[model samples]
Target: MLTGADGRYHWPLPPATYTLTAHCPEDGSGGGTGEVTGVVVTDGRESTADITVE
Candidate 1:
């Protein structure tokens, strides 16, 4: 989990399929959610999964 003032994050993991989800709170009610699925991370490379909640 990530928490702070910055809206950026990063993670390093082994080669595999992964899923990333991001959520943002709105007002005082329920929040919004975004997800990125089937992210294939390979060896000796960089993979990006950007999620935006609006």
Candidate 2:
């Protein structure tokens, strides 16, 4: 999924622990990748994970 202009993305998944990763392609300038591991999501609750790519 792609993030909006604010660099925010939304994805719904079944309640469980997961590891998420995000990557930005290098277009000559620069690019990087980030990952968030051991994320927990519960029913009727919201989980937030902030990843910063270098």
**Number of the predicted model whose lDDT against the real structure is largest:** 2
Q: Residue 41's C-alpha lDDT in candidate 2?
A: 94
Report the lDDT of model 2 for residue 4. 92
**Backbone clashes under 3 angstroms, per model:** 0, 0
Per-model lDDT: 0.81, 0.91
* C-alpha positional error of residue 36 in candidate 1 after TM-score superposition, expressed in Å: 1.1
Which residue pairs clash in candidate 1?
A: none
Q: Which regions of candidate 2 fall more than 4 Å away from where they truly are?
A: none
Candidate 2's error at 6, in angstroms? 0.3
Q: What lDDT score goes with residue 4 in model 1?
A: 58
Across 1-54, the per-residue lDDT of candidate 1 in tens digits comes to 674577767677899999887888777867889988999999889897778775
23, model 1: CA deviation in Å?
1.4
